[model samples]
Target chain A: MLNRIRCLLIKELTQIRRDPRLFGILIMAPIIQLVVMGFATNTDIREIALAIRDNDRSFHSREYIRALAASGYFRVAALPGPVAGDARQLVAGRAGLVLVIPPGFGRQLVRRAPATVQALVDGADSNFGMQGVNYLNQATRLFSARFAREVAVDARLRGLALPAVAAETRVWYNPELTSRYYMVPALMGVLLLVTTMLVSSMALVKEREEGTMEQLIVTPLRPMEIILGKLLPFVVIGFAEVTLALPLMRLIFGVPLRGSVLLLYALSGVFLLTTLGLGLFVSTLVRTQQQAMLIAAFFVMMPFILLSGFIFPVENMPPAFQVVAQFIPLKYYLTIIRGIFLKGVGWHALWRDGLILLAWGVGILSLAALKFHKRLD
Target chain B: MLARAGLAPALPLVTPAPRVWFNPELESARFLVPGLIGMLLMISSVVATALSIVREKERETIEQLMVSPLRSEELVLGKTLPYLLIGLATMALILLLGWQLFGVVVRGSWLLLGLATVLFLFAGLGLGVLISALTRSQQVAFQVAIIASLLPAIILSGLIFPIRNMPLPIQGLSLLVAPRYFIEILRGVILKDTAFVELWPNFAALLALGAAYNLLAAHKMKQGL
Candidate 1:
């Protein structure tokens, strides 16, 4: 049985090696896809366009506008007109935020009286509007503090303490809140699914389409042996992709590998079984490679990426989606990957997700094997 | 089309609330349909055209066509034209459905929308032809089609991720991607009621990319790839 499987593996590898273009694309496509998309997924919304109508046009108002721009979150554009209050920028979609600073302006600030600045946000983009509000709020508080200090100094007063609740936040794991730090590791798991499941699903379909499936079925090898033979090479490819992607991710994107490499490989081995098995199941359902590609992509791959907590937080997903996500092997693998890469925790922290992934591997691999055997018969 | 598109951005309205315009209820469909159109165009144009051409090669029908009186350019046109028309038909259906089912209507000019969709179809079909020319099997074409067109279009096109928020370097690179302009035009027309004057640059870029890609595909077809 082992010998028969080895022959099949060698035959498959030889075919892949012969088609260098496909092999080259197969090797590089997923990594390049991962890197390009992963790098672009900076969820931190920065550089939100702001159209500010500075009513005061005072030194302090200009200083305040400069501070907002310097924070690197908002791009400030000054409107020459008075506080028209109509928010033309928002109406036109040119800017996500609009600010109208009242003329009561510098005098109120010099006396430490209440200073009022009106803000108008475009609600058309919910996420952008929310983030812009948050950043603007923080920037204003900082600017106000600085202005208050200068006023106290000019008056020759020793101390002016404004009572407030200041949040001194210390973020752990990903210190800078860079979305790349969050997405790159999650993308590693997504890459495994794209490379392995789609490749394996298409493998048998390609054979059937080429009229070689019957030839393979007529061979002396058992169906289980053939299944392992087909899936095992991709298992190797999946590992090689991860192995290659790891250092490249580190070098290019500065994605840290905090956990033990050995441990990651161990968990990855378990995850591949689930993906390969899912691919085998997909292969049994398709006639042509095109059908295989579409089904695998739309049905399997899309749902996996969505539910895997890669982009939208799985916790934020509705209860129904959360329930459906429980069955997805990629979901478990993601927790393991993100935990290992970002949190640097070991078996104690990750054992539950690891265990669930292993069970999924065994469950799905058996189910796929049964289906493949039935198809062969 | 050009005059209407050029004249539209000249007028501006004052919103009662800065956050919500046009969409008072904030129906997710209003935000989603434009991106959906962009994604569907990619799948149908790139995947459908590439698959159709590669299927002919796989089934050995291309040899029959090549031996016939048709020139390679005509063959390319014959092959891609149906898909382009079909893509437009599909876009129209989607617009109808979007309005009927989701109440997400196209506020921009229909002529401008049609032109953008046609230009985008050419760009997508060119990519399909290029992939078909490169690969011998449907499997390879399918993989390459997704990687080269669909993935980049979805990610780099500001369909899901806003292009304005991207780092300037990535934003610069995104200019090479055709769907960026298509989706931008779609959103401007569909959601924000943006006029053609505001969107002429995007339309120009789409036309250039479409011509470049189709011309390159023609060159490859003549070379017998």
Candidate 2:
């Protein structure tokens, strides 16, 4: 049985050795893809258009005006002349953000009366517009805090009334709030799912097309043995790929892994099993390589990317999509990788993820095994 | 119908074209270079290798090849090298075009990129061989190759979505996919100007993956022996 497996493995290697183009793809595609992606995917959004309607010509209002301009998140495309009606034109023109400082001369501040500043934000592109609103709000809040401090100090230096309680705002996960830190880790999950499904599914289809599968079927080797022999090479290869990927990210992209390496690999094992099983199952269903490739690509790649919380948070996804995302092995795997790499959480925190992966692995493997048997029948 | 007085064709109305918006220097990368590399690799490994093996089985050429003095290694290399070299040449052509047409800079060290490419080639070749081992037909091999190529290179390598924000389990899964490492090395060398010390672990992983995969291929290639 061992010799049979070895013989099959050797035959496979010989075919690869003879194919130069495949060898090149394994080597060159990554570099080309990276170059294209690095240039195309930029998180830092620049050159936003903003319209401002200033109702008061007071020094305070002017100061606020200056603050908005200095924030660099917006470009003052137009300034309305006294009327809110003129401001409406800019918004209609699809200006991304609008600032309207209401008419309240310096008298309101002197009397300690409240003042309101209105900001109309565009939510057309949710990701971009939402981030813009957050930035605008932060800038406005800082300006208010500084102004309050100055007023209190001038009113009374030593005996200034201290607030009863101060609220401290702390952002979780990403403190600097750089998008890449969050994005790069999430991308890893997407990439893993892609490679696994593509490799495993295609492997089976290729075998069936080649007629070597017929020979193998006629041979003494069992279907289970054939599947294992096929799966082991990819699993071993995939593991090596991930090991290489980690430090490259650390050194080049500055992504840090704060968790135990062993734990990460262990979890990956379960995840790979699931993906490998999925690919094998796909292979069994389709007779032609092209059909298998298309099926795997469409069914696996698109949904896995959109719903796996790779780009948008699963929490933020519509409940229906969220429920559907649960079935994607990547959804579970993404949480595990991020938790280990960033939060450094172990089994105490990650057992759920591990269980899901194990369940997926077992489920997919059984399905694949059954499918293999069906093909024989 | 034209002879009838009422049959004169109405003159076509002239319409103005839609007003164009300002296009702000949107630099787009022509994916042909990478696309070609991916396409050729997929074809050679999954399509070509599978077809050849299937044909051999159908024609009873397998018996002749097995009995020949050529070792399994020689047979595999002989069969696989043509495709491998073609893939490499295609890669070089695409790289040249990418630079000339798109101004895509190769920021990483050339030596490191070359070494990483070699390792990645080994892995791809190994994977193709492994796929060939498991199947009896070209269709099965091609399907497997597509599955392997699509995911790891496209998503897991930080090519499309940033890897950082991915929930934890997916990240763990990516660690095992080889293309993720190759993409790292490629990106590290080309975009980040990464050094060898930084690229070594990825290279090591590729080497290990390639070695292990090839070993399995070697074992499977001599199946009847």
Report the number of clashing residue pairs per model: 5, 113
Residue A151, model 2, lDDT: 53
Tens-place lDDT digits, model 2, residues B86-204: 66775677678778966656765677766776676777777777777665544445545554555445555545443543446556755656766766565445533657765678789
Report residue A47 deviation for candidate 1 (angstroms): 2.4
Runs of candidate 2 with Cα error greater than 4 angstroms are: A23-48, A53-61, A72-94, A101-118, A144-179, A210-212, A317-322, B1-225
lDDT of 2 by residue, A48-116 (tens): 666777777788777766776787767775474656464343223346567666677344554544466
Off by over 4 Å in 1: A80-88, A102-115, A150-177, B1-33, B85-115, B164-169
Give candidate 1's TM-score: 0.85
Model 1 lDDT tens row, A287-374: 8777777777777876777667766788987899899999888988988998899789898898898899889888877777787778
lDDT of 1 by residue, B23-116 (tens): 6555555676787788778766887667766787888887787788877777777778888889999999988998897788788788989989
Instruction: Indicate the TM-score of model 2.
Output: 0.57
How accurate locally is residue B98 in candidate 2, as Cα lDDT from 0 to 100? 72
Chain A vs. true chain A, TM-score per candidate?
0.89, 0.79
